[model samples]
Target: MGKITGFMEFRRLSEQSSPVVERLKNYQEFMPRLNDQEASIQGSRCMDCGIPFCTTGCPVNNIIPDWNDLIYRNQWKSALDVLHSTNNFPEFTGRICPAPCEAACTLNINDDAVGIKSIEHAIIDKGWEEGWVKPQPARTKTGKRVAIVGSGPAGLACAQQLARIGHDVVVFEKNDRIGGLLRYGIPDFKLEKSHIDRRIDQMRAEGVEFLVGQDIGLHVPPQKLQDEFDAVVLAGGAEQPRDLPVPGRNLDGVHFAMDFLPQQNRVVAGDVLSEQIKATGKHVVVIGGGDTGSDCVGTSNRQGAISVTQFEVMSRPPEQENKSMVWPYWPMKLRTSSSHEEGCQRDWAVATKELIGKNGKVEKLRAVRVEWKDGKMHEIAGSEFEIKADLVLLAMGFVSPVQKILDAFSIEKDGRGNARAATDGAGYYQTSVGKIFAAGDMRRGQSLVVWAIREGRQAARAVDEYLMGSSSLPL
Candidate 1:
């Protein structure tokens, strides 16, 4: 659609990452952006196929082909408009999203995807540089107030949408900062806090008030919000981290990944840590070979760890996916993150049996290689071994949202312990309580930031319609 023969003319060009040695020195963004011309060439590779499976592949249902075509034609402003129409924060998704959209791109079936993610990143970055990104205050005031709990991506997106619709919105966060997980869980190297800061500034300019250090269900009663605001939206993240309940789980050097990651992030933000968990000079063993574990590896390397090792219970994924069979859908395959590129030993099909330590501190990890047969994991005989470890970070992921917080609201929960809410049909996202609503991880459980944004925007529409009997906001 862009160049007619663009797909045949141009090949995919991805953003370049900084050299591993240089990037590992400090916690900063290392991905180098593409020049405008280079980005255009990549964008032009989009075929704009009739099916356009990339749209469905993206969690936010971004208008991928339209923007790709616009970018290829050097219509920067129009491309930005198309991008902003669907995703409130293309910048965030462009940087950290897994980009399943590219995986599902028709071009990917035969060759590389059109470098869609990089093109998107370039477009948003350009928009910001050109001062084209600005606050969009509602033209008319609705005079209705809404309270949003948790200022993570979900709450922030919901508040932004509600504010854009002329509703008075206030986001309450328990932490001292506006961003929940984004400000804490993610490292500064991956996503600098300034990105979040500027967006918060924009939201504030749009009439969305943020209240940091305000815990809705804790210090401030949930009933208070319901009474003060016309409607209340719950967007608290699922933060109950899954832990390894092994013999030495209670040891001093062992900790949850959430507990460990936030401290490092805070320290990077120039906050003085009283008791920072440092991997300095220690042999670090990170359990769970997910993104979080990879993050730990990077952080530990930065901390000058003697050695870093990551463990995964599941069998290793294939080096390459059978594209013919899994095209247009996310396929399981081995993924090595930038952090992994720096340094670390990754082991799969290995389960930690117990933590061994002396003097009440974690010292070693005892594990065994496992073999799967008939849907069961069997430990191999004589496969047990011990790895030296002074620190252990459990990054197995989250179990559910903090139950006590939800319990404070007396909200009904789904079988998964998330807030019971529907996303389809009219009256969607309404909690058991008449005036209450739910979205994001609190409603759908732990998920990607893109999914949270989608849920938040949709829930905003639901709440808006419920309040005024009509809504012009897009779901």
Candidate 2:
């Protein structure tokens, strides 16, 4: 408590974003980080609660209070260190995380929570501007090689930790780039690929080798890794998209969200496309109103879609949650993303009946309004309607990691199709295959990047202990 009554004296300040019309003009980051004075005030709003529920709420378990105080005092270098102590990459989480940490803050009981995310964002931005962020190479060599299959957050975090602790780490990415979802899945407007590229440069300096365009099972045999490397970490994330099988599912205009989103990302990366799917002059309809669906809406608008509409199977959530019931935990509530604000027609509690197409190309969709009773959905009588849609994007979510790679190693899978592995007690992160480990979405299913980083760091610790009978790596 640097200023004893700072929480009572200061009000929370949110990050500022550019006007919708201006930002929609191009694919670039629009939110400007909080200035120094504004960040210090936001940091002062921290209650410094006895329990500090914000840390419990954050998946990475950041030491929030310590960093807040450091930022309030304008000691940014120290604040950045405290922020990075737990989280390997604050920049990614600062930009994309939903910030459950704020919802669980002590001040959020009756007042606005401290701006922890924006403060973190400011700290990291300053760290980079001042050239404070750098790589830490191992002091001694372990002479043991570890192979990580995936360039997503989980694999990257795990490899970084192992590399710092004297293990020879090699990251194999199936795509032409190093970042898995960060490079392709997410839109550049939210997180530009340069952040990932810079981190890759740092990792390279720390002695981690990256081999792109190598599909483990298809391009390289799994046995070769088992025979050559001392250990392997399977961090291949959940890549299977959920399908909407309707009467006109095979229509030429229908595609998965991943298929559409990645194509646009490639174009932004200066790649010329021949078979690219475009929303130009088309009426776009995005199914399943999650982050993926919202992303589709933004991309379609930028691609010059005539109109964009989003549909959700579930009923609309409450504008505000009942904090009494869900305090200190993530609650269900209506979330309107910046993309939605750009321009979108949102409808909830709707069910897709079938796709109505012409000449094998989707032109419209048939749907009905539904009501939920006792957790079961029932279509309303005479509530059928048709919506014009030339492009239909399935953005419901992912199911599991690619099964072929797992099967190649003969790894046991859970009921959810994710690799079966324990999180604690002996055999932690170890798969059915000897000397093989699984982490992140490969073991846990689809999740947030913060959780992926957590799993990766913990998995690295487990692997280190397994190799040397102990580890200094933080959990």
Superposed on all Cα atoms, the candidates' RMSDs to the truth, in angstroms, are 1.0, 0.9
Candidate 1 lDDT tens digits, 53-143: 9999998899999999888889999999999998998888888888989999999998888788898899999999999999999999999
lDDT of 1: 0.91
Instruction: Point out where model 2 deviates above 4 Å.
Output: none
- Candidate 2: how large is its RMSD? 0.9
What value does the lDDT take at residue 427 in candidate 2?
A: 77
Please identify model 1 stretches exceeding 4 Å from their true place: none
Please, what are the lDDT tens digits per residue for candidate 2 over residues 207-239?
999999999988999999999899999998899
lDDT of each: 0.91, 0.93
lDDT of 2: 0.93
Clashing pairs in model 2? none
